[model samples]
Target chain A: MKALVHEEKTGTKGLSYREIAELEPNAGEVRVKLKTAGLNHRDIYTLQRHKPTDPPLIIGSDGAGVIDAVGDGVSDIQVGDEVLINPGLGWKEKSDAPPQGFEILGLPFHGTFAEHVVIPAENVVQKPQYLTWEEAGVLSLAALTAYRALFTRGQVQSGMKVLIPGIGSGVATFLLQFAKASGATVYVTSRSEEKCRKAVELGADKAIDSNGDWHEALGGEKMDLVIESVGAATFNKSLDQLRLGGTMVTFGASAGDVVQLNIRNFFYGQFNLLGSTMGSTEEHREMVQFIEKHQIRPIMDHMYPLSQFEQAFERMEKAAQLGKIGFHIR
Target chain B: MKALVHEEKTGTKGLSYREIAELEPNAGEVRVKLKTAGLNHRDIYTLQRHKPTDPPLIIGSDGAGVIDAVGDGVSDIQVGDEVLINPGLGWKEKSDAPPQGFEILGLPFHGTFAEHVVIPAENVVQKPQYLTWEEAGVLSLAALTAYRALFTRGQVQSGMKVLIPGIGSGVATFLLQFAKASGATVYVTSRSEEKCRKAVELGADKAIDSNGDWHEALGGEKMDLVIESVGAATFNKSLDQLRLGGTMVTFGASAGDVVQLNIRNFFYGQFNLLGSTMGSTEEHREMVQFIEKHQIRPIMDHMYPLSQFEQAFERMEKAAQLGKIGFHIR
Candidate 1:
């Protein structure tokens, strides 16, 4: 099986497109003939700094394919069923905290960056019928993250006002759609005016120029919830725009990590700051149902053959893409 | 009527004991002849810096007394009824956010420091028959803040592990009792060994020294919830002790307001940081009921006559007390 493997120690130069052995399903697992896979910043991080001396690794958390075989004890799913694989491991149910040893598929375990991958059988969910191969492959990670942050944690409801900052990421796009579909008025902030305009063309009610006076752009309307992924650059501003006792849910810190907090403003206004990551297996199933029901077509920026994995990585590094960048695996 | 007032603009010495015009109940109001009043840090803030030019404000928020008069339309509360005042003004119901104009009783409004106080009839709830006047007087503000932070915002439940840092404030003492009564294992931290010993004697599972090796003292036990009122001084350590996906509910920042947040740690660990002030009127009522059902007695440090207001203020400002300080106002 052909795989896009990061082989060197330095940078993007480490990526090597070559053949790798296909894995067979273990007990309670299934083999997937991956049709498409998504590229993410996590993949880039591994390629740049993860040394070759580390255990053999395959990188890619989002993928869509057909189940080629099922292991012993897998009774529900069958061979040749079209499916999307949830990358989260060890967290199969909703819990107040992730179970110990919880991890995302990709690094330590062989992932969908290859032509064929074997994952736990329970990770496979029937792909949303309305999505294309590329959309289904890229939707799991970002959509699940957005779903949990917006609905599960933020408890967004109809008539609530929601804000998503750094609107060009895949998760941010999904948040805009999810909030609007759930009947919330959505606002977005992006450094690129073109991206801002594009978001409004989608279901967002308004888009603000991130470099400009975005706070004033809201015209004094307070947000009921904020989906924050852009960390230091926008955290305080995002919090400032929330109405009293409103919530801000975060999943990423792309720009920087250390942020100064105004504790008095936080307590006096009774604000809630919640942190979220991907989601539970139940949420993944519900997310697929939601996307299919709403007919949400995940925004994809570009797709390349498995051989052009380096090109896709370069595009993501430059952040030149507006949405999920991907790979055609089969 | 005799009242304790902050007469000047500088420090605790500005507080004076004087005679003032007796209050008469307005429409929909009742006048209470105060028997006991609880002193808080907010009173110190007013005495230390609040300008004398502001309305003739009497400083105290927690009080229990006998209703002496009822104004027009005040049918529920009648003369000679024993009651405790819910000191939050303008917030009459549970809301996602406090309505505009919400204020505590002690700033622009004349408060419970006087021998007589006229407040809206709706603000009075029957005092629990099991409590002494001193306990009921001091319980309202601290218990309300702690109840909301623990049960309402933190979503605490039986069998959870709870941590309260910088113990010995009125709020901290209440949080310890509330968490313990709710079937949580409560741990506390304080710089003073005597205070820590006092907390363990009051049903806390364990007490750790705030300035010592407190983290090591926990011996790898992670907190499911943290009630954070000490703020900047212990914020980072408080967060470090929380389990992944645990919540930290903060009500006050007594040490300082400016704290550094490690955004990566927050999002990666999926932590929840929530801010809560005083609870709603509905929560106040519920808290009173819960206290009565549990037969909880609020911990009091010392009581001074109304004429000894300066000494009480000095004790609080110097951080010398372990629990609520108060005025015996009869």
Candidate 2:
């Protein structure tokens, strides 16, 4: 079996599609032949020297596949079962991870960007036969993040106002639909007028440009929850746009790194600044159930073959797409 | 009547004792003959021109007194009932406030440093008759703050590892006793050996010097709740000492303003940066109950005649006293 091996950690440019010796399942690990993989901006950070790891990085955090083999004492999963990989599943191993919290996949170790990814048995969750590999592969990170933001951290309620800074993100699109389905009025942002219009067609109550004029975008309305991933640029505005005592969950700071801390702003309004990370495994499992129960499908932007990983990454880098960028492994 | 009044819109130095027309209680007001006023560091900040209020400044926030009169529709207390003057009382007549957040006492309104003060009927709560007036004056801001920090915000449990950054604050002194009462192991920080010994006698399990070391103060241990108020000085270290999923509640920022955000510190450790204002009416009510039930008293450090308001402020500004500096009125 061969994989997308990286001699260096530089993201797209580091990959060398060459045949390597097949890896066998280690103790408590499962060897899965990946059918589909999802790409995220965090992968880019790892590649650009932000995340330091040993060479030959098999860097992918999100993937879905069939179990080719299971390590000794594996009790839950069987060979040939379809599954979605929990990227960061260490703490679930009942090992070093503290009780109730675990590590995320695709972060420090070899990821799922290849044909076969060896992961801990705890990291694999069974996927339904009815769902396509493409859907299963992209579901874990984006969907769980949105679920946590809307329900877990934010406490978004029916008839409440929620603002998503952009609708084109894999997570943002998930959040908009999730909020709307949960009886919330959704506000989306798009840099392009066309994309803004498209978001409205997709059930957004209002769509505004990603540009700084949010006051006019929503007619000077204050929202109950603001999902802020575009960190520095939209942060101050998010603070201003939220109703008093509202929550702003900052899970990602994509636009820029620095975030401002204004004591008077936070204290006077009684704001809750919750820094949400990826999410819990229990939350991820619940998210899958919710998506399935609601018949919700993540918005698909484009799909590519394994060899065209560079093309997919380039598109993401250019920010030209609408939803998730997926790769269908052949 | 004579009182200290600061124009809330301006930070000025001319806050002085002056005679003013006695105010009749409004429909939902209570008039009190203030016996003592607690001096807090926030008063200095208001004096430094923080609130943008005009000033012929009369500054004092925390107070204790006897009720003199009640307006129409007021039924709670009678003349001469001992009570605390909650300057930043939330819940009535003020909608711009966080439903029940801290009221900006003394800055925008005439304060307790005067002979008499008037406010909403709800702001006056019964003070423990046994407590000294100076002690009662300082009780709410620090004691209620400690209550909220531990039980309300931090939800501190029995047998938990707690790290407190400073033992000098009135809140810190209350926390030492409160944590011990809760059966928790409390470690406190101090630059003065005398203060440390006093904290130990009061109830601190261990007191460590902030002699340019983190692990030493921690006893090479991690904390479950970090009491942060020193702002940039201790903010970074507070986060480091917490266990995974631990919390740091910042109710005060005495060292300075401005806290830097280190993303990796947040993601890797699973820390929570909780911003707590003073508290709510419910919190205040609960704290009063706790105090009455436990017989906890504010450590009154110094007291002067009401005419020596400037002397009290000077002591607080110079950080020359521990616990509380208060004014005694006739």
Candidate 3:
């Protein structure tokens, strides 16, 4: 199998393309011949040596492909069936299952940044007919994330005001579309003027510049929900702009994780500060349903063949693209 | 008219035992001759000037008294009927109607720290016959607080483990009795060993200290509910000790208000951090039932005459008292 593997932590090509031995699937496992794999900022973080030190680490988390093989007692799928590998196999289909520590694809384990990756049968969801290979591959992470944070945890509702802090980030883009689909009033901010305009074109009710003072500009009326990926620097400001009893859903910490808040504001006005991680498997299924129903599409600035992996990493490191920048590995 | 006025930002003696102009009942108002007044920490906050200062601020919010006079067209009660003032009064009530915001006593409003308080007729809940003046007075804030935070917001259940950060704080005592009545495994903590032992006698399963590695002492078993009045320094420790999908209610920040948290922990684990100000008037009625049904008696530490208020406050300031430190004005 010709796969991208990080040898020594240097640059993006720290992952030198090489032919590696493909392993046989274990019992209850299925091997996926990847058609397309999505790249995320997390992959870039690992490339920059932000992740645990391990040579030959496989990087991509989200992907879609055809099933190549099914292990013993796997009555699940036959060869040639197209599917979406749920990026995180450890996400329990059973709601009552206990937590499986460190299971996200690409983070602590071998990932989809390869020609083939083996996973348990439960991690595979049938990709909807409406989506392309590239779309299905990328949808697992971003769409499901937005689904869980906004719907299940955030309890977002129709006709409510929702604010997303930045434009063109994968999660932010998905939030914009998903919120609109749910009948919420979506507002966004962007460091790039063009991205702001693009967000509005993509269903955001309003898009402001990066430095735009959202709290004051919105006057005394505050948002019902705030999707905060950027942290620290914007945390207090985010809390300030939420309506009394409104919730702030924090998923990422592009800024710093630690933040301080005035406790009185929470009690007197009734505010909730909710922290969210990735979607549970059930939430991911919901994501697929929502995306297929609303015809929501992820924004991919560029798509390349697996061979151009180095170039893709460079663009991602510089953030020179909008939304998820990825590669197909067939 | 006589009122215990705080002339300057000083302890106990700040209560200037002086005469002031009488305030007549305005429209929709009634004058009550107070029999018993409850003490909330907010009054202390006002005295110490931790809260914003405007001198001559009337103290006390929770009051049980006789309706001495009803202003024009006020027919809710005839002269001399016993009632408990609904301190947080947010809505108007019919003459034969129910009380509205009954739980928010001793906040910014002109409270009942004196012999007479003029408020709208709607601000009163008819006193149940079984309660004594002291029981009726103290039940409004602390008792209702525990009910709302534990059962209402925290949704505690029988056999569930509940952790209250303090042993004898006004709310903590009520929480201890309430959780025990609800069949919960109640745990309390205090800096004082004596206080911890006393709390165990008051129905706490265990009383941990706020000192040296108390979290490890909790055996890593997650709590179902944690009632937090102490804030900042203890928030993370509480969060860490909570199980997945556990609820932490923050109603007061006795230690400090500002706190930091990792948002992901809250969202992914389905952790809930609810901020409760004061429960509704219905909650006050519920607390009244709870107290009478449970025959719960507040832990009255000592009684000080109005003139000895400084001594009472000194006890509170030193955290020497296990229960409410009160002053009698009558």
Instruction: Please report the candidate that would top DockQ against the real structure.
Output: 1
Candidate 2: tens digits of C-alpha lDDT, residues A1-330: 556666654556677666766778988999889999887776777677533356566667889999999999898889999999877664432111136535556655667777888888888899966578898887788887778767877888999999989677888888988998889999988788987887898899999988858898689899888887777767778778888767777677777666657654565565666666666677777787887887788777888887777788888787777778888877
DockQ ranking, high to low: 1, 3, 2
Q: Which 10-residue window of candidate 1 chain A scores lowest in summed lDDT?
A: A6-15
Across B1-330, the per-residue lDDT of candidate 1 in tens digits comes to 888776655556556778888888999999999999998877776665568666456788989999999999988777999999899988867766689999888777888998999899988999889999998888898889888899889989999999999888998998999999999999999999999999999999999999877678999899999999998999999999989999999878889999999888897788999999898899999899898889998899999988888788788877888889988995
Report, to 2 decimal places, the DockQ of model 1.
0.79
Q: Please, what's the RMSD in Å of model 3?
A: 3.6
The models' CA-based lDDT, in order, is 0.87, 0.75, 0.76
lDDT of 2 at A328: 81
Model 2, runs deviating above 4 Å? A26-29, A48-55, A93-103, A106-110, B5-12, B46-58, B92-97, B100-104, B191-194, B209-211
lDDT of 1 by residue, A1-330 (tens): 888776645566776778877888989999999999988877876666568777556778889999998999999899999999899898878766578988888877778898888999989999867789999899888888898898789999999999999988888889999999999999999998899889999978999987777667999999999999989999888999999999999888878788999898999889999988889898888888888888988889999998888788788777677888888986
Residue-level lDDT of model 2, residues B1-330, one tens digit each, is 777655444443556566767767888999888888887877777777545445454677788888998888988788888999666566533222356344567756666778888888888889877788778888877787688777776778899988888788778888877877787999888777888888788888888885668786566798988877667677777778888667777777777667666544463454666666666667778788877778888877888887777777777666566687777776
True contacts kept of each: 0.85, 0.26, 0.53
Question: In terms of TM-score, how similar is model 1 to the real structure?
Answer: 0.97
Number of backbone-clashing residue pairs for each candidate, in the order shown: 0, 17, 5
Q: What is the interface RMSD of each candidate, in Å?
A: 1.0, 3.7, 4.9
lDDT string, candidate 3, B146-259, tens digits: 777887678889989999886767788888889999999987788889999999888888888877465677766679889888888677777777777677888888788888
Comparing 1 and 2 on TM-score, the stronger one? 1
